[model samples]
Target: MSATRDLHDLGQSLWLDNITRDMLGDGTLAAHISDRDVTGLTSNPTIFEHAVAAGDAYDGSIRASVEAGKDGEGAFFDLALEDITRAADLFRPIHDKTDGVDGFVSLEVSPQLVRDTAATLAQAKELHARGDRPNLFIKIPGTPEGLPAIEEAIFAGIPVNVTLLFDAKQYLAAADAYLRGIERRVEAGLNPQVASVASIFISRWDVAVKDSAPEGYKNRLGIAVVQQAYVAYLELVASARVQRLLNEGARPQRALWASTGTKDPEASDTLYIEAFASPLTVNTMPEKTLIAFADHGKVGEPLARDGGDSEQVLAAFEAAGIGVDALAERLQQEGADAFQKSWDSLLEQIATKSQALTA
Candidate 1:
């Protein structure tokens, strides 16, 4: 069996962190679902930006949106919605069979609204409703300002994939927001069964510390960070608060490892995927990584719930003068800014493409 199937059997979800109109039209995405055990997918401004800018696949749709009096962000969403909803439909069976535990496709709000609590909430609701798919998750950044929006969005009955989290603390904060939303729902006599996932980016930590670390520490920080986060996740789900919520029919916001593609040439292509394998978590990987993993990946024993050796590994980094707490905050901010830059470029691309297709 393919290693992808092994990971699936191990109960770690493998979601493709990519989407494109061409992939959908060409049966590639469907094949990944059927053949590679990819139960879900995720999209960001960067992914959509690349999709729209890459080929003539989107040209006809861009022209139609332009002719229909849409441009810029509006045109982009119209295009994105079409692709996401279609992907959502393709995964609907897994979604139904798993009873909402898997088979989700995430669509993020404009990164420009990351700091705007009210606007973020509004757009999240709008996008969730617009998509009208049960398995769709409207992604909101896990920034401070975004926490309230996340709470509000979840309370309002929208499933959220909280993004931009860099470490365990950030993941906890996102979890708090999700739980608060569920608690509020229970208080208001509403269904507290809203599904959510807190996405903790994995590879970026290694990238951030690669230059300053010793040879022994290279490409290890990210896995250690995720291991630590997994400990926290295990604790959170086992806590009385979360257990109570679970009894009340609320779902736990699962830990999701994102940014999992190896950025280092010397590293194993499946570096993050192999080390971060644990049940009850999601690993959303790039297309290259997914294909690489299926081709030659190996799954080891699952991560230790107690975070074996993670503290010791992190202590080595700390001894090397890496302040992990501060670094997490910086990475989160940098991630948001990078997404915002991509969002801006995406809008510009839509506008430019709209004109080109129309002219």
Candidate 2:
């Protein structure tokens, strides 16, 4: 059996972290789904920008949208909705078969609106309606401003993929917002089966401290952070609070490992993949990383529910003068800034493409 299948059988959902029109048009995406056990995928403005800028694959659609008098976000979302809805259809079977536990496609909201709670929620609802796919998750950042939006989105029965969380506290805050939404639904006599996932970024932590950490602890911080969050995840899923929601027909929001590709060349190619093998969660891999893991990856024991040695590992970092809580906040802000930059660039690219294609 393929290692991807092995990982799937290990009870973790393996999701593709990239998407493009070319992949959808060709058999590449279909192949990944069939042969690589990729039940889901994710996309963002940056990925879309890369796909559009890489070639003329989207020229025809871009021209059509441009000619139709659509511009900027509307035009861009038109293209994104087309691509993502098609991808979502391909996974619809897996989604239904799993009873909605797997086979999800994520499309991120405008990173430019990260600090605007009302706008974020509005756009999230708009995108969710535009996609019109049950398994299509509208990704909202798990920032302070986004927490309220996350809750409101959930209460509205919109599935969310809470993105850019860096630590257990952030994850739990997002989780609480999700819980509040579901609890509100139950109280309002609505279906409480809203699906969601809190995506925690890994590998970036190690990169953040690569130059400052001890040689022996070169690639351990990221995994330690994930371990710490996983402990909280296990606790949340087992808590009486979540149990009460389950009784109300609500699905527990899953914890997803994002930014998992190894940044350190000296680290194992499958470093994050191997360390993050846990059931009831997800690991969204970049295209190459997914292929690499399928080629020669091994799935051993899963992550510790109690977060074995995480406290000790984090203590070591603390002693080294690395304040993890502060670092997590800084990393999250940095990540948001990076995504915003990408969003700005992508909008410019879209406008340029629109003009060029139509002209």
Candidate 3:
């Protein structure tokens, strides 16, 4: 069996961290679902930016939308929604079979709204309503401003993928937002099982600390962070508060591992994927990483629930003058900014392409 199948059998979801019109039209996404056990997908402005910039696949659609007077971000979302909606339909079956636990496709709100809680929440509602797919998740950052937006979005019954979280604290914040939203739903006498995932980016941590850390600690921070977050995740699920919510018809918000692709050339290609395997969690991998794992990846023992040695390793970093708490905040902020840049570039790309196609 392929290692992708192995990971699936081990109960960790394998979601492609990408989507494109070509993948949708060429049946590549469907094949991944049918043959490789890929059950879900995630997209961001960067992914869509690359997709729209790289091909003629979007030319006709761009022309049509441009002819209809849609331009800039407006034109971009229309094109993106078309692709995401189609991808959502392709995954709809697994969504139905899994009762909405699997087969989710995520669409991020404009990264430009990352700092405005009200606008973020408003856009999330609009996008969720526009997508109109049961398995769709609105992607929001776990920034301070985004926390309230996440809570509001979830309370409004929108499934959210909380992005750009870098540590246990960020994950907890996102989880708390999810719980608050669900609790509000319970209070309002609505069903509280609105789905959500807190996406903790993995490899970026290692990349951030690579030059600062000792040789032994190289490429290890991301896995240790994941282990620590998993411990928190287990505690959350078993907590009285969450258990009560679960009894009230709510589901525990899942912890997702993002940025799982290896960033260092010297590192094992499957380092993040092999290290972060756990049931009920997700590892959203890039297409290259996904194909590599399916081709030659090995499934290792699952992560220790108690976060074995994570504290000790983190202590070493602390002793070495690495302040993880401060770093997490910085990383999350930088991530949000990076996405904003990508989103702006994406809009520009769409504008350029649409105009050229029309011409």
Candidate 4:
């Protein structure tokens, strides 16, 4: 069996961290589903920006959306939803097979809404309604401003994929917001089984510390941080609070490994995917990383529930003058800013493309 299928059989979901209208139309995404075991996908401003700017693949759609009176962000979301909803439909069977746990395609709200809770919540509701696909998850950042929006979005019964979490603390904060949302639902006599996933980014950690770290610490910080988070995840899953919620029919918010692609050319392409091989979590890899893994990646034993040497490795970083807490905050902020930049560029691309296509 392919290593992709091996990971799936091990119970760790493998989701593609990309989607393009061309791929959807050409059966590329379908091939990943059948041959490589990719059950779902995710999209963001950067991904969409690249798709729209790459070629004339979306030219006809852009012309139509423009003719239909859509412009700026309106036209972009219309274009994006067209692709995301179709991907969601393709994953619908896996979604049904897993009872809404596995198959989900995520669409993020406007990154500009990151600081404004009300705007974020409003746009989330709007996008969720606009998509109208049960398997679609409207992504919200896990920033301080975004936590309240996440809780409110969940209480409002919209499934969420909480993004931009960098460490266990951020992951826990995101998880708390999700639980609070479920609690509100149960209190109001509503269904508490809203699906959600907290995405924790890897690789960026190693890149951040690469220059200062000693040789022994190279490419290890990210794995240690994720291991620590996995230990916390196991504990949370076994906690009495979560147990009570399960009994109340509320679904658990699963952990997702994002940014798994190795940025450093010297490192293994499948570094993060192999490190995070375990059940009950999701690893969303880039197309390049996914293909590399299928071609030759090996799945090792599952991560130790005790976190193995994570604590020790982290202590070494601390002793070497690295502060994990402060670094986590900085990474999340930087990630949010990067997405906003991409969103701005995406809008510009849409406006330019629509004009060129019309002419």
Candidate 5:
């Protein structure tokens, strides 16, 4: 069996971290779903930016939107939604088969609203309503301001993929917001089955501390952090509060591992996928990494629910003068900033394309 099938059989979800019109039109995404067992997908501003800039697929759409007097972000989202809705439809079968537990496609709200809670909530709701797909998740950052919006969106029955989380603390905070929203629904005598996922980014930790950590610790930070988070996730599900909600028909928010693409050339290309193979968690990998894993990946023992050796490894980092708390905050900020930069570039690309096509 292919390693991708191995991972799926191990109960870990392998989602593609990309989407494009060509992939959809050419049966590439469908082939992955059929052959590689890919169950879900994720998209961000950067992904859309690349998709728009790389091909003539979006040019006609952008030109039409421009003629209709839409430009910049407005024009871009129309094109993005066109692709996402189609992808969502393709995954709708698995979505129904799994009863909404898997087979999700995520669309991120504009990063420009990262700090604006009100606007973020509005856009999330608008996009969720516009897409009108049950399997679609509107991604919201896990920033301080975004937590409230996450809760609001969840309470309103919209599935959310909470992005930009860096550590266990951030992950728990996002989870808390999700629980709060569900608890509210329970109190109001509403169904609490609104699904959500807290996306904790991996790989960035190793990238952040590679030069600073000693040789032995160079590529180990990211996995250790994920292990720690997974432990916390297990504990939370077993907690009395969460258990109470579970009894009331509410589901625990699943933790998803994002940014799994390996950044270090010397490290194993499947480093994150192999190290963090835990059940009930989603790992969205880039296309290259997914292909690499399907070709030569080895499925190792699953991640320990008890977080074996994670505390010890974290302590080692502390001893080496690495302040994890401070670094987490820094990384989240950097991630938000990077998305904003990408969003700006994407809008610029749309303008350039629109003008050329219209002329």
Candidate 6:
């Protein structure tokens, strides 16, 4: 059996972290689903920026949107929706078979609106409606400003993939937002089965501390942090609070490992994927990482529910002067900034491509 299948059979979903029109046109996305066990996908500003800028694959669509008098975010979403909804259809079978537990494709809300709760909600609802696919998740950042929007979006029956979470605390905050949304639904006599995932970013921890960390700690911090979060995830899923919701027909918001692509080239390409392997969670891999893992990814023993040595490992980093809690905030902020930058770039790319396609 393929190691990718092994990972999936072990109960962790393998989701592709990249999407482009070419991937769809070339049948690569569908092939990834069938051959690599990539049951889901997640896209971001960076991914779209790269996709639109890299080639003429999107040029025809850009021309159509431009001709329709769409520009900037409107044109961009038109392009994004076409790609995502098609990808969503590809996964719909799995989505139906699993009863909404898997087979999701995510599109992030405008990063520029992350801090504006009202704007974020408006854009989120708009984009979700635009996609119009039951398996499509409108991604919202897990920033403080994003929390209320996350809750409101879920309460409105929009599935969310909460992005940019850096630590267990951030993950829990996103979960709370999801819980509140479900709770409100139950009280209002709505279905409480809105699906969601709290995407905790890995690898960024190590990237952030790479220069400061001792050699012995070089690539270990990210795994340790995610391990700690996994412990919290176990507790959260088993908590009576969530159980009460389950009784009300709510599905527990799952934990997802983002940024699983290794930044440090010297480290094993599959470092995060192999280490963060735990049942009932997800690991969204970049195409490179997914290909690498499929080639030789070993399913190591799954992460211990108690987070074996996670606290101790984190303590060692603390002793080394890494203030994790503070760093988590910084990383989250940095992530939002980075997404905004990517969003700006995506708009510019779309504008450039539109002009070129029209001219």
- lDDT per residue (tens digit) for residues 196-248 in model 1: 99999988898998799865889888888998899999999999999999999
Q: Quote the positional error of residue 212 for candidate 1 in Å.
A: 0.4
Per-model TM-score, in order, reads 0.99, 0.98, 0.98, 0.98, 0.99, 0.98
Q: lDDT of each model, Cα atoms only?
A: 0.93, 0.92, 0.91, 0.93, 0.93, 0.93
Give residue 63's error in model 4 in angstroms. 1.7
* Candidate 5 clashing pairs, residues 3+ apart or interchain: none
lDDT of 2 by residue, 167-212 (tens): 9999999999999999999999999999999999998899999998
Q: Write the per-residue lDDT of candidate 4 for residues 207-282, one digit (tens) a residue.
A: 8998987559899999999999998888998999899999999878999999999998998898899999989999
Candidate 6 structure lDDT: 0.93
In model 2, the Cα lDDT at residue 47 comes to 81
lDDT for each residue of candidate 5 in 160-278, tens digit (9 for 90 to 100): 99999999999999999999999999999999999999999988899999888855778888888999899999999889999999999888899999999999999999999999888
Which parts of model 2 are misplaced by more than 4 Å?
none
Each prediction's total of clashing residue pairs, residues at least 3 apart in sequence or on different chains, is 0, 0, 0, 0, 0, 0
What would the C-alpha RMSD of candidate 4 be, to one decimal place?
A: 0.9
The digit string of per-residue lDDT tens for model 6 on 1-359 reads: 99999999999999999999889988999899999999999999999998888878888788898999999998998989999999999999999999999999999999999899999999999999888999999999999999999999999999999999999999999999999999999999999999999999998999999899865888888888998899899999999999999999999999999999999989999999999888999999999999999999899899888888888878988998889999999999999999999999889888887777777
Minimum summed lDDT over a 10-residue window in model 2 is located at 44-53
> How far out, in Å, is residue 88 in model 4?
0.5
Q: Candidate 1: count the clashes.
A: 0
lDDT winner, 3 or 6: 6
**Could you give the C-alpha RMSD of every candidate to the true structure, in order shown?**
0.9, 0.9, 1.0, 0.9, 0.8, 0.9
Against the correct fold, how does model 4 do in TM-score?
0.98
